[model samples]
Target chain A: MERTYVITGAASGIGKATKELLEARGARVIGADIAGSDVNVDLTTLQGRQTLVSEVERLSDGRIDAVLAVAGLSSPTVATAAVNYFGAVATLEGLRPLLAKSDSPRAVAVTSMASLMPHDDALLDAFLDGNEEAALARAAELAAGSPEQGNLIYGSSKQALSRWVRRQAPTADWAGANIPVNAVAPGVVLTPMTASLTGTEEARTQLAGMVPMPLNGFFGPESVAQLLAWLSSEENGHLCGQVIFIDGGSDAVIRGDSTW
Target chain B: MERTYVITGAASGIGKATKELLEARGARVIGADIAGSDVNVDLTTLQGRQTLVSEVERLSDGRIDAVLAVAGLSSPTVATAAVNYFGAVATLEGLRPLLAKSDSPRAVAVTSMASLMPHDDALLDAFLDGNEEAALARAAELAAGSPEQGNLIYGSSKQALSRWVRRQAPTADWAGANIPVNAVAPGVVLTPMTASLTGTEEARTQLAGMVPMPLNGFFGPESVAQLLAWLSSEENGHLCGQVIFIDGGSDAVIRGDSTW
Candidate 1:
């Protein structure tokens, strides 16, 4: 039987790569994004999220084999927190019923190595608390203030999102219901998101210094997409709530053995 | 010259214990809480935090030697996130200027072993995002919905606060300006906060089973107070952004050497 999967942020970057890979495997893909996708949804607002869910339900005939929440923002802004944290969560939770209809349901979300970076406590708290408007509002204020502030919001949003995945995975609706939920925390993947930074030697050198990728240079989107695809597969039954960092040893270097 | 210190959540629990210990050492102490203290302030609100700061500044005569943000909530509530994460943060950040005036300054916030427990992602993000209203609102909704939901909110709040302390400890205003900021995460301690849970034998047995305390049973507030005193001492200059878990080896047991 061909599986049906919903891949958000499917227009480009990791989402696009994952969508193509899954489609090649003979799966029916329902791609959702801001543009150039089978399902167009903003994912940054409550209405957008509701639309995405309704559309996915309509397209899949109320049955979804898997969901890959790969849509995200690399820059700091209120919208970053809204789309990356809330948007990803809304996609996963809102479509959970559709996923439950499948024999083997799997959900994968894209976090980042940035989750380990310093974060704004306020922004983190807002996201954790589930106040989308307030979290976005705070993120907007910080983005307008300083670059570091923006970075903090982005990092915290990812961290909180990863934590959410872990917390929800063990619950009845997920692991109990046989739905494997997990997140992929990639290091510096070379995608359109990082084009500006990796476009020049000066920027690349600076970025390289910031993240210690002992294994090799930055990763391509395909490498991360492959891991994500596997995680969203039927074989990924045993893994639940794990945030697998494919960051070329950056997480190991930074966190060491602290959170292991 | 007598050193002056400010302690929030001083009315009861860890804050009270710490206040008693500090006064015994001959430090002039200013206690703050909702009632029965030198300053009456509700830490769950911005205005309350401002009042606490202004009052501390006024009472300390413009110089504060140390600060202990020990007030916290063990139960799950929106107020838990507000008081645990925001209250502690506001107490520390709001009083930094006064701490900067001292020759040697130290700040300590009380996190909890519950931080390692499963948490709500939305609550954690809201706290980190620094949106108190949203975090509180979400927390309220969760508390009203489920008992476990409340526990999650409480745990995630402390976790986010601990993360914040670690992130802020090395900044210019902290390590650079000679003020050390850190947090102490205690496991199960016998205090007013845990009275209901630890008071009964059945509750004690259930609690013991939940947390693995390899060293012993529950800890007294004084054991935590001792660690807090050391962290807030003038002799302690090098420690920064560390959330030292003084929880009878529970942290070590749960996390193992993975995050060492």
Candidate 2:
């Protein structure tokens, strides 16, 4: 059977790599992005979510084997909260019915190592509470403050999204229906999203001090894509709710046995 | 001043190993368990939780450096739910005040690789909702059923505990007060707890079939002990809400990239 997949943020970066990998292996992927994809729709809005559901359903003939909610923002704005947390959640929830028709339905999303960073408690709470309006308002309030405050918007969005994935995986809609829903927490990848931040040696060092990946300093989109492809595969069945870190032992080196 | 530590389940297994390792390094340890330890309190009860807090405070003179909540049960009984989830939580939460007295405070607990297995949704919800009576009742109901049904109690307890550890890691008390709290999920370990299950070659093979640790196969309490000691160390500052798996390559092999 030609497995059908719907991938958000398929225009570039990790999403692009994942789309390429799955397509190369003879899978049918319906790419969705703000621009240059089969379904061009902004995922940060309610109308965008509705459009995505109808379009993906129409394109795939009302069936999808998996969903990869890879689209996200790394900026320090309310827009980051809108796209990263709210947008990703809406993408998964809205498209879940289309995915339910498959025997081996899987879902995976992208979160960041920044999830571990200190964040704004109110904004994180609002996202978890499912109040998009309040979440964006909180993000806006933080944005008008210092740079560290701005960073919290990005950090909290990623953190809340990761927590959401973990909590939702075993819920009735996903795990109860035998669909394995999970998320990937990448340390720092060399993609269009983070090129300028890690382009120079000085920038890389500074980022490394914060990220501190011991295995390989900075990897490309392909490594994360490889992992993402495997997650969305039918073979992966055991992992119910996990945020696997793919940063060359950065998790081991920095976190140590703290998590264990 | 020497660091003072409180370790539950110090009578045997991973806690005993961790206690020995930490003490050998010149730290002072106040061991606790059901029997054969400094404070022999049954942590499955509220009175036991209160006893542990008061006694540990007396032993350490109202001050402690770290808390290792290693007491747990793997049986298919309500006692397992009481001890594994509620007990470990009380061990840390009860001793947290004493830990805050130290210049370097840390907390860690032990979860299991079985946490990834299919679980009872109602029981899991009960545990998460902080309803001990309900959780135990649900566990008792499942324990009277088939072997697989009985297994869900242990799995759900561990799973719930792991989630609780993650959620609490960033909250007002632990992370807010600068106490680095985390958990470690181990695969099968050759200890008093699992000696009968993984004793013979046949039994080990059966266990391996379920666990699927591709790296070094089954591990020992010493390996987990080393990690627990590090998590309690002052050096671990970056990690929050992480459950590091010390299960050879079981997590990696089985889960693949589902979480990444």
Q: Candidate 2 overall Cα lDDT vs. reference?
A: 0.83
* Top TM-score model: 2
Number of the top DockQ candidate: 2
Cα DockQ of the candidate 1 complex: 0.02
Per-candidate DockQ versus the true complex? 0.02, 0.04
Give one digit per residue, the lDDT tens place, for model 1 in B1-260. 68788999889888888889989999899999999999998888889999999999888888999999988877766677788889899899999999999987889988887889998888888887888888888898889987887778888888888878766665566766867676778878889889998898999999987775544457678767766776687645444555666664466556542332
Chain B, per-candidate TM-score: 0.97, 0.98
lDDT per residue, candidate 2, B69-169, as tens digits?
Answer: 99998889889999999999998888888888988888998999888888999999999899999998999899998998998999899989988886676
Reference-based lDDT, each prediction: 0.80, 0.83
How accurate is chain B of model 1, given as a TM-score from 0 to 1? 0.97
Cα lDDT tens digits, model 1, A1-260, are 89999999899998999899888989999999998999998988788999999999999999999999999988877778889999999999999999989988989999988888898888888887898778888888899997888789889888899888766765667766778787878878889988998999999899888876654457678777777776687644444566667665566557642443
User: Cα deviation of A21 in candidate 2 (Å)?
Assistant: 0.3
Off by over 4 Å in 1: B1-260
| Native contacts present in candidate 2, fraction | 0.03
